[model samples]
Target: MSTPQEEQARRNAAVLQAIGAQQPAQPEWPAQPQPPQEGDLWVPPLGPAAIDPTATAEEGAGKLSLAFWVLPDAVFGMILALALQVIALFGFMAAQGLKTQEDIQSLQFDPTFTLIAAPTLGIGFATMAVMRIRLLRKLPWSWFGLHLRTIGPALGWGTVAGFAFLAINFASGLIFERLGSTPDQAEQIIGPFRSASSLQLGLLGLFIVVVGPFLEELFFRGYVLRAIRQRLGATWGIVLSGALFAAPHALSITTGFIGLLAPIFIGGLILGYVYQRTGNLWSCVLAHSINNLVGFLGLLAALSLP
Candidate 1:
């Protein structure tokens, strides 16, 4: 209804009012404050997990980097010592002329049992000594799990297997007697076969129960079996070690023939299997002890029979 100029002035004023309403009075910023460079913002670069580079597979189970730990070195050292022991045994046997029946019987006076024990113990000591060397060098004996838990099973199974071995021997002896075949005497067989006084028997039993098992387990199952397993496959390791185990019995003149060899071979197989399964020496030791005990007990029973 107003004049044209008045109408134009009103429209312009309304446009100005709308523009003023849309324009912000001051700039708004993000709600979060910027992180401090020294505190929260500094993220260091991450590399691979901390592990030694020289370790074997057995040494680096869950490690990020493969590294040589102390255990493998110690174990290798033990193998070296055992190899040396075998050579020494061969040398000594050759020197003593322990080939024929007379030579073997004569040498029994200076028992291989006593001599072999020294080298076996030395191997164990040397392995532990090598581990100490690693420790001094500030290397990883840290990762080695000295599992005492495996002892129980080792002892239990070793005893059982040992008893089984004795049973086999007794049965074999009976079969030989029935067939009118003279049994060849093996060292272990003779060692237990010869009956001294009751005191002597008791002492021998003690040795069988304790020392024999410990020594055999250490040398055969613990060191020999484990080392061979590392090189050969486990089956080969068990078989070869078992054969080697029977070699000591070759000293027996009367009973060391093919007949006795069968049982010894079979016994070795059982023992080697036990050692492989347990990963502990105690089981083999216990099994060996129990086997000897069974033999001793059986002998006494036979002697006492009316």
Candidate 2:
């Protein structure tokens, strides 16, 4: 071993040698965030995505924000509309002096169907107004995809979707029929028009082909769809919205036939999908109109039969 002074001299020499050596360069990181790399999974945000405050235009209401209003609005809108319909029908029956049950039972539904458009229109207008008013969080109508900017896609894609839905619905109907199901709901729909007056037929046709579809799209594909989509995400949103739409038809007067629900549900899904992709309320409306037009023409054919 060296002496203590020799050890100290060696350590000092080594330290001086290290200080004179050059260091390797440090890496310079990129300033901006890098793109997602391969094999990366997208983790969803922790909770309802907040609307960006700095955004130039209205984004949309978060799912949590809408949870309180969606169910109530749907229920109230339907109940109010239905109540109006019943009241109108009763008033008409009283006006006609049809005291007998037989006379009331024999009353045709073409006028009733045509009249339903009035109350439905009122409800729709109210909904639109309420949703757009700034006091109530002022949900932008455009956020619900109710805009004319995408008119072409809305019309073209929607019409194609409607036709496709009809074909698929027909095939599904046959399947149900094969399984001992009856098309009772389908028949009931055309039942009113069977012996309807010319003027009443024209009015009913207008309602089903135009007004009905527009309003239905405005509700189902518009507000209902967006609300559900916000909470459940796109897939479940489409599913539940469609299911909710088909549920109301469980009434005997409507296509309450269990077998018919499949087609109706599928139609709802198509409408939801179209609305989602096109982001245009009128697109879904036009698509719905196509389906209605076809059905209306078929109703005319049945009425023409001897």
* lDDT leader: 2
Residues 113-177, candidate 1: write the lDDT tens digits: 33443345445534553343343333333222125776666567767777778777777777766
- Number of the top-ranking candidate, with TM-score as the measure: 2
Candidate 2 per-residue lDDT, tens place, 1-306, comes to: 899999998888788778895444699987875565798633333543332211223324433345345667777777776777677667776777777878766664544544553545446434643563333655666765677896986789888898988886788878888886655654665666666688878887887788777767767767667766655566776888788777766653443366778888998999888877887888888878888788888888877888
lDDT of each: 0.57, 0.68
Q: Stretches of candidate 2 above 4 Å error?
A: 1-26, 33-64, 108-135, 252-256
Candidate 2 similarity to native, TM-score: 0.75
Q: Ten consecutive residues with minimal summed lDDT in candidate 2? A: 50-59
Error of 1 at 117 (Å): 11
- Give the local distance difference test score of model 2: 0.68
Clashing residue pairs found in predicted model 2: none
Residue 165: error of model 1 in Å?
Answer: 2.8
